[model samples]
Target: MPSTLPSASPGTLQLQPDAGAVHLRVAGDWTLAHYRHLRQAVERARAPLAADSEIDLSALGALDTAGAGLLAELIGPARLAQVGRWAPGLPAERLALLGTVAQALDQPPAELPRAGWGLADLLAHIGRSVQNLWRQQKQLLGFIGLTLQTLAVTLPRPWRWRVTSLAAHLEATGLNAVPIVALLTFLVGAVVAFLGATVLAEFGASVYTVNLVGFAFLREFGVLLAAILLAGRSASAFAAQIGSMKAQEEIDAIRTLGLSPVELLVLPRVLAMLIALPALTFVGMLCGLAGGLVVCALTLDISPLMYLTILQRDIALSHFLVGLGKAPVFAFVIAVIGCLEGFKVGGSAQSVGEHTTSSVVQSIFMVILLDAIAAMFFMEMGW
Candidate 1:
């Protein structure tokens, strides 16, 4: 008599010597729970498994992907393709699992190349930077052309002029800024006069301090100072205002109504700057000369009469014209750069701040660069 009871078992492999080949029998659960012992069992039995071995899966139990992978390690990928002929009793799903695992294990992932720190890398970085700068300049040039085209088309009609907006921006960019611009130029003028007096006095020519102050302010410092001030002050303001509007989706709404943002938002600011900057430059020149005069009266004891005489004798109208002429160009570039940056906003507070800072930096750099070029041109042309 035999007892009829279910038995618990670990995975096992047994080899039997047959007529001309070996019979390899697999049994029990080939799962994660039995992975360690199953692996060791397969390792020990796998030595006898050759191309002509017989695989008996009829006695095989449960299986999973881990076990399938271990089976692959034992059988090798080439044998996995012919699993059907080797183990005819194996289920279709189990055959598929074994094939998949064998393929995955056979083809390992390739490694990624690491970056190097060398001269080639440095040159590559510089090339990328130059490309970015060129792209930015192209955008600026295109924007300028678009603004001019719009101006040409719109300015011919008096009815479409944005008078109220222009007035408001003019006051903000020009009139309200007068005090600060004037004060800054005045202080700079005084410093220049002091330095001139000190240096010239060493050569017994302290009286030429008046001529130095007049020539400096009339030809360079006056317009340069005013433009730089507006770049920092008004350019940031323009970028912030337009950026906030963009972030709030007001710009999108404006476009939905078929309104031109360039005309309504940008042109007014640009025209205002165009009108205000020259006036501001003139004021800056006067204020700077006054500051120099005061410094000379106090430090060098040069009379106001003598200072005027020296200014009239030494400084030509070309110097004044040269300084003032640069104002409109500076004004237009600053305004365009500011508005362009504003339009570039990504509809977020952080993006607005970043563009606002960018506008100011770009405006100042352009002003200085254009001024330098203009100086060289005037000097070459005998102005």
Candidate 2:
């Protein structure tokens, strides 16, 4: 048995060494108030504890969680348990509390393994990205094919047509869009004329600004601007509208009522876009030309009559046809992409917003890509 040590003050430790063991005597207020001294004593007593050491907690007074935690850390959990077993004279509650703290502080938390930065990991990431891209392309193509199939099936049944919905969509997607499209194309036309005048004036060819504006607006800029604006405005609107219905389970409800969502919801919007875009393109062309005429009159001193005469003489009918011909194709693509994205929405408001944004981005990208291909084809064929 270890020799009895002298009583230590509150927040103090007394270490008494025996032949082969040490007795750790703790007494007084072992609490937050005396934490500093208790911590120092615990630290000093740490080196003396061995496998044969014993902790005597029977004399301890006013023990709390913090002091118990410090004691556990110093003596380690295994010896702390032995101390509890040997010192039954200690309060049961205090020993139980010490055991709880010992268990909690005994082990450190496990760390997560870091990812490898080897060539195999890099190649795997690239392969996953490629697979995702391929999957997305397949989904888009399948959607396009479905839309076309629905159109073919529905076209022969005039009795099934929803004229009111078609008219409403036309007014919403087309008539509502006119002012902004006209305004944007008009401003762009004026800017183009100004640029042409500034650049060509160096070569004493300022009058060519009229021809440049006429050619650009008729062949490219007018339809391109209108289509891009509709992509941002109308495509997003379609996605949000259909996505909201999807979130509410309204599409499923429609199907339960023996109605086709594609025919009822998508066809009207698609047809409306197809009809509206051509009219919008025509308006954009006129507004663009009017803007160029105004710039010519003010800056180049070219009268309206001379501008019209020059335009008629230099600009061919084929230029206008080339631009107008692309409108229906662009409109079809935008409408289908928007409705497809909307149908893809999951049952959440966040899903609606994400797919809406995606619809706009995809529509704009497709329109630009198609326009570029058409332009290259026309150029190669000398159309």
Best by lDDT: 1
Cα deviation at 345, candidate 2, in Å, is: 1.2
Q: Report the poorest 10 consecutive residues by lDDT, candidate 1.
A: 2-11
Cα lDDT tens digits for candidate 1, 1-383: 86433236767888898997998887887887788888898889888888777777787787888778777877787787667777777888988887788778888689986677789888988999999999999999999999999999899999999999999999999999999988998999999999999999999999999988888888899999999999999999999999999999999999999999999999999999999999999999999999999999999999999899889988899899999999999999999999999999996899999999999999999999999999999999999
Model 1 lDDT, residue 12, Cα: 82
Error of 2 at 379 (Å): 0.6
The TM-score values for the models, in the order shown, are 0.74, 0.72
| Cα lDDT computed for each candidate against the true fold | 0.91, 0.89
Instruction: Give the candidate number with the greatest TM-score.
Output: 1
Residue 357 alpha-carbon offset, candidate 2, angstroms: 0.8
Instruction: Quote model 1's TM-score.
Output: 0.74
Tens digits of per-residue lDDT for model 2, 165-191 = 999999999999999999999999899
Model 2 residue 41 lDDT score: 84
Question: Lowest summed lDDT over 10 consecutive residues: which window, candidate 2?
Answer: 2-11
